[model samples]
Target: MLKLDHIVKDFGNHHGLRDVSVEFPANQTTVIVGPSGSGKTTLLRTIDFLEIPDSGRYQFDDLDYDLSKPLTKQEVLAARRKLGIVFQSYNLFPHLNVLANITEGPVQVLGKNKQEAEAEAHDLLKKVGLDDKADVYPDQLSGGQQQRIAIARMVAMAPEYMLFDEPTSALDPELEVEVLKVILELAKMKNSIVIVTHNMDFARGVADKIVFVEDGQIAYQGDPTTFFNEPNDRIKAFLAAGQFNVK
Candidate 1:
């Protein structure tokens, strides 16, 4: 399980995160949904140590971190490895082929040989339904295929948590389903998966829990059944404004 208490972060011009607290159960999908600039991305970054919080405490499985003090570079990197972050952009090495991109981290960072890493990469490619695209470069694939490659790269890292920052937001509307399908498969892998997304329909389909954030804070957190069927006025307003088309 992952737990956060009193997370606080301040950007130069904004409250990046504000006294945020939440818990994520193991082997479950937790979707953080809200408007743009609502601190959903910031919260995920802090958990992965991309953004340092001014104050907070996080418990990830057996590891616990105090965010009140500064963390060293090594400490930050270590934390990041525990929770792999996949962003809006695929961020694959465009110069490299899909197999190379997926195996890069394992060979370089995880101390695995090319053969071993390639084996893992092949398995992940097959898992993401892209086994045939192993030799293709990022430019040769569609947006959704590129995103799946990015996800496969993270799976090779073997992290306990996968932090996704709008993984499908960059794709064309028609291309979104392909990426969402891979995400749904990841959620079923029995790891704690946290995603920040505007895709309400995808969230409802996969998330065991949903969190609504606004103004740098979590306005609500509940099971999907409650969040969709019986939301507070705040959530109702948000859903109405976005016309999320929840079903």
Candidate 2:
């Protein structure tokens, strides 16, 4: 469903991604694993059009985005509608209550009426197990609750592809599982998902494909089973350095 060809992004003298190429199938979960500065987040952001590449091409279904050309505002918005990106931070609006925050996108982007958006927001809240917190403000909820609400807000937009950048990194151990449950459930759905995560167990359990990125390039890409069980020396070294226990 998604393809990146020779994608390269440079931030001054540092390279964010170099000659990165990969294809993600429809309705499958792909987990990108790497240490810090490994370009995992950059890859996700590029796909979401949050970071435009200096060169190369990105394709989603029939749509083609040439990074060499300047991106039009309308094109960027159109591309974003099909994808939802959850940042490391919850990025929820502090001023808006849970319901209002969740419904804003639909009301503004989708042009749904306020009443209709609110109704949809309620259903999304229930889906993420946050129906009771709909009336609560973001500050009133726990970190996990806020993250789940963030997920619900994204789901409300009905994105065809979801990008998760270290979804559980900001949470405590106990809180992490709560957010992971929602993400795991989303993985089971028939939609494309790209998750950049350090949670080895979650990646092993939910990913159809595991991509190990290092130094701004794909070091290894394969089935999760093989990746966990029979990784190469480079991968083993990386896993060890990251203190990722594969069990």
For each candidate, C-alpha RMSD in Å?
A: 1.5, 1.5
Give the clashing pairs for model 1.
none
Tens-digit per-residue lDDT, 111-177, candidate 2? 9999999999998788888899887899999999999999998888888888899988999999999
For model 1, residues 1-98, the per-residue Cα lDDT tens digits are 78889999999798988899999877899999988889998888878877888989977776788889777787777667778889999899999999
The TM-score that candidate 1 achieves is 0.95
What's the lDDT for all of these models?
0.88, 0.89
- Displacement of residue 27 (Cα, Å) in model 1 is 0.8
For candidate 1, the per-residue lDDT at 88 reads 95
Clash totals for all models, in order?
0, 0
TM-score for each model? 0.95, 0.95
| Model 2 worst lDDT run, 10 consecutive residues | 238-247
**Which regions of candidate 2 are displaced past 4 Å?**
245-247
TM-score of 2: 0.95
- True-vs-predicted CA distance for residue 151, candidate 1, Å: 0.5
